[model samples]
Target: MPDNGDLRDVESTPLQDTGVRVFAVPPAEGAGPGEIMQGFLEALTSDDPEYDTARKYLTSEAASAWRPERSTTVLANGPSITTDCVPGGREETNSATCVLTGTQVATVDAQQAYRPAGGPYRRKLHLTKNPENGQWRIDGLPDGVVMGKSDFQRNYRSVDKYYYASGTAVGATGQPAAVADPVFVRSKVDPMTQMVRSLLKGPTAWLGTVVRSSFPAGTALQKGVSGLAPDDQNKVTVPLNLKASRVAARTCSEMATQVLFTLRNLAPTLESVELRGAGGDRLCELNEEHAESAAWLGSARSPEYLYFLDGKRRLVRMPMRSTGTGAVAVPGPFGDGGRQLQSAAVSRDERTAAGVGNGGRSLYVSSLASGGSLGDPVLTSAGASPADRLTTPSWDARGDLWVADRDPHRPRLFVLEEGASEPEPVAVPHLSGRIEDARVAGDGVRIALVVAKGGKRSLFLGRIRRGGGDGQETAVDGLRSAAPDLEQVSAVSWAGGSRLLVVGQEQGGVQQMRYVQIDGSALDGPAPGALPGVKAIAASEDERAPLVAYSEDGVVRLPSGTQWQKIDKEGTAPVYPG
Candidate 1:
């Protein structure tokens, strides 16, 4: 079964139509050999956990030194290549990476959004050979969800006899045995208080990505600029570096509840900025009368909004809506919604302004002080279309905007609201793959959660229309995607109206920022273990706060607690516009 598709446009890559296949090749006839090692541990848990198909059946250096990012280093256990293979080792072949040590099996637990729902992962597999095609296959495993080796050697011999008999506690109370040794999961952080602390509220916005290399161009001190942030020890910028320069760029703006970062360098067209609470600034400097360009910018009230980008960035209906009296009418992105402005929302009594694209998909509401556009583009319709990748929208209280459509690889979620004709989508139930985040608090009730690309997930809170009606979601209770297990939970926010603020990873890969407190029950009792990427994350209904920003080389601040504070006296990456 070799057809995992898209392996460089088909040329033999078949891993059986995608869910990847082919494991145990030695078995000659009637099933047995533990059903060929349970179909070679279900083709090493589906696909691409990348051991490059277990180094083509492990041509061994003791199985790439038991590859788990190499470290712990081990080997020796060779003889048990057991797929039960009877008949004189049923046609053995040895070192095809010793089948990189095959082992896997977890039929279901739809990868609890990547760890936390029913928690349990230990999968470790391998088996390769295909030096371009001899065959064998299998490979890699544990991106989470393993359990099968006689139920993981009976839950690792009852957690190695409750942490070696008395040296510690499973639930704690007098104890004392011995024989421990096989311990794993390493991101720890649960001394007792956790269940995602009610999603602990307030302060959000942390988006930094600037790698450039060389130095000069417009050098705002980039290569390793941290300005401030020390404890949350994302190491205040671990070995942070950024010197090259393709004219850095990265944007984000909200104003008046703050979040106005726009570092742009387009070669000589300057615009540097740095503001979490507000610090580094220099808003503009483009030449030939500034044609810099406007990738994006939001906010239309508190402190003003609309700056799509000069010579008509469009959508300017703020406290500046004047037209008749003193005169001041600049509004152009029209809306009978024949579809023009693909994104923009302004209701909360700013009258109304919604969108979905031009040529009419529907979801438009206009009237910035009786203006011209906004007659349609408010909610568009027809067979579900308008979804330009939505990074983060969140409208709620019945206005319905809620847009965290992140989709990093099919990580689902979408909602438009108003009269409800199309935008629905929500499938996050046991989450399937990649989302990095989804926040929606305030009056949406709660939805904060961080998804994964490979386990380490926690900080849930569910409920907004969930219940038993198909999407099957009820209790949310979080705090297992690990905090006590150390740290990983990627990103989450809602910090007020019920609390919820997460954004994780501690110890080495760094970046730790907590603040959970949503009262339901952090996923009840168990289910913790999650971690992956995403370094910063924010969310704020203006102070309903939920921010966990971080950068490397320098700059850390974990807010919910009292330590970690450095506005980047070091950390780089924030040059802008990427």
Candidate 2:
């Protein structure tokens, strides 16, 4: 085995969890084929920036061909190596083949988008002994890099790059709604520079159709420019290529806002970002305050109140910031209990709401303000039972209402534009099961659904594709499991731009609550502590708000850094404004 060594320099920074810096150790002299392979594998997991040490174990030809950034394959454990001499080689008779085998867990593409993967992983590396130095060097190998899941977690961090929703505008805000596109990057590396480059590349293929980038086409960092870091005032200056040099002031400001939002999470101390053109002339400088005004981040807006169904099956709410405050019914028809509601959803603006009542057979829209009468059901289902009728309605950022009708004979998902138009059936191609519940994302481009099939319920996330002016019907495409491990999902709500709070039971396990990413990967942090008998759950886009749930103990809330506390014994379905 090669001896471990410290290769830290003046510029090296400590690893994420460990305070000490870790670097790759070059192969030792006279090392065996197995030892050489082991050293090369270890080097792939190190923070060598350019992977210079890892290349040392490879022959010059192989080194020139290897592209570590092409893709990353994460395994369940470190790959196992088995080496054997070739039966009869041509040019090099003294060559050995090393086979690496493991179970693949996930993969990160060149675009930095992460997707859960499974199945066996196999790769081959051919080695030959240098005649002059008698040193073993890999002559042929696969592209990119492979490492264990633990190393991937320690070396990489997930960050969201900001984009604007493609075809919607926030009312009166005069700004497009901001959407988050999550990607993984090396934490200790020059992450700020990496993130900026990724943002300039535009949204990933999966999200490209629904979101638009502020950067102009072919926009990129100026040639040979790298190593971006915040200055003493926590400000970062980005130099863009010629394509972005001639953008107008407003468009330039929008581009700067995207950089500010993307870097803020990676460097919380970031106060502003200045964009410079290829000519080294300042294009625009956007401070934190101005950035907020440039885009509408739905998740950053705190709700005014927490809404839920009370004992009388009426809509009620309590101040979001006040704990231990008694809930009161709003001054509306649904609040007066004249028309009992089974479930409800409030619009993003909080001026109106949509409720499902009459044993879930009817859907009604009403104003939350005082002195308003409840209108007749805008939509109805002919399902035989309440369970087979309308699910809870959800309002999107565009004020459109979404709900699913689980009637086994006529199952369908409907969207009411502006919550007033006739119900329009949403086409979900390749959907195999009945949608038990549906929740549209605040960006209006994604939807989460709890689908029931073969006596099992699962959570799925899908993209909402609107028709081009040519009269194409709106459809939900690319449906994939969001919580594949959960055998039964009772409820789900968007926790953030790319996360969902889920209540479900794993195969042969008791019911529990956890957070899952839209890409079907488990979140990094600990899941919410176990809560018994969780029937339904709710979470605000703003993470600071408490999580509300309806369980056997009635409606309860899990405040930040605290245990679950009862909100109302009679409240059965709890919800926050979409």
Candidate 3:
């Protein structure tokens, strides 16, 4: 657990299984090779800042060469060790080799990026009798630390570092949308300082092309500075290298805003951040209020209303901030039922909407105001059946509309820039099968896709890359599985900055709803309780809002700490503004 600058003193207590802090016990005198290996592995999971106790079980040369921070290998379970003595070894010069084996689950690289991995894990530890005290000490081992999944969960925590979306025009908020790049860091090892360093290092490889950091190139913490903590006033001060010393005032404020947002996750009480130049001169200062003006955080902005298709196949909505409110028809041709709709999506600004009509063959964009007229279909699909036509439309913060055409004859994903120009086909490189559903994230840089192949549906996350010049194309690259374990995925929605609410079923199991991270990792909390006959799901980036679902019971919602309750039995295809 993190200590948030509380000055109160507490009584010293013995370490137990409380799961808050773990202290490593030094190896016992005259311990055998097996005991030494066990003690050393256990120490790697402890909260020791420098892993000094773990190094005690290694030879001097091994300790000098070991680099625990190089990487972390996560195994499905604790490693199984087998020891064997060297053959034909002299009695006075006995040597042994210990083999450690397990199943690899994931890995965290030196940059603190977590990637799902699968395969067998095997390593050899060479040990020899220490001539000084005749005790077993390991002389050769793997380069980095290894631990079980449970230990990794207990020792580290996931945090999102914010960055500005690259190459995106300013939205209604008059600023570039903020994108979240999540990474795992040691929980009790000065995480506040660790997160600041990560923020300065820029986004991960997959996200780097679509996001830009405010920090100048080569900017880093001043030499020898460590252990950053908030002051009594709930303010933190960050000192930077010379590279950031000559930045403009606006750039300096942007830099401070990034730090303020990143650190708030670990220390919510933090009120402000101050940036200083290499010469200790104040560069800029920013608070939560000011940070909001620097960049738009989609997750922090709540939707004004919840829109869905009513019983009459007309677009309707209810106030998002209110409960028990009756649904009302929206103020447009869609509300008048001039053209019956099958599905709908509201723009982020709540001023316009896009609906798929004519049994999913045509898509129309209209306003949410009264007397608004419906225009010709901006996009059309040639699928022979309704189930094989256009999917539900989705809007991004930039007001761009995204929808997938499931036409078996010409399956493609299309995007309407500002929801007006001719539909442009978006390339999906390396996609294995036809797309069943597509939802663009609020940041407009990441997209969640449901693809079906061989009668199985899986969830994938792809990065949206736009070409540099005109006449060029936009493509979704780096498609990776977001829910690889599920046998079938029915629906997916962005629930937060780096989280998604997923509806799927595991192999040999019933349907279920859960939250998953973009990196394919499970969230720490319990999933939403079971809801029967769920056809579609909707969630807001603002998690405080209820989770809306279109089920057999009609429109239903799941409030915080409560069971699902019926909202509108007549409503279907519920959605919140993107």
Write the number of the candidate with greater lDDT, choosing between 1 and 3.
Answer: 3
Q: Candidates' TM-scores?
A: 0.24, 0.94, 0.95
Evaluate model 1: give its lDDT. 0.32
> What is candidate 2's lDDT per residue for 464-493, written digit by digit as tens?
987668988779998988988899999899
Q: Which sequence of candidate numbers ranks them by lDDT, best first?
A: 3, 2, 1
The C-alpha lDDT values of all candidates are 0.32, 0.89, 0.89
Show where candidate 1 strays beyond 4 Å: 1-27, 30-35, 38-107, 110-445, 449-458, 464-502, 507-509, 512-578
Model 1: what TM-score?
0.24
Query: For residues 253-294, could you state the per-residue lDDT of candidate 1 as single tens digits?
Result: 111001111111011232232222112233222222111122
lDDT winner, 1 or 2: 2
- Which ten contiguous residues of candidate 1 have the minimum total lDDT? 202-211
Worst 10 residues of 2 by lDDT: 82-91
* Candidate 3 per-residue C-alpha lDDT over 98-172 given as tens digits, one digit per residue, 9 for 90 to 100: 899999999998888888999999999988887778888899998889999999999999999999888775565
Best of the two (1, 2) by TM-score = 2
Local distance difference test, candidate 2: 0.89
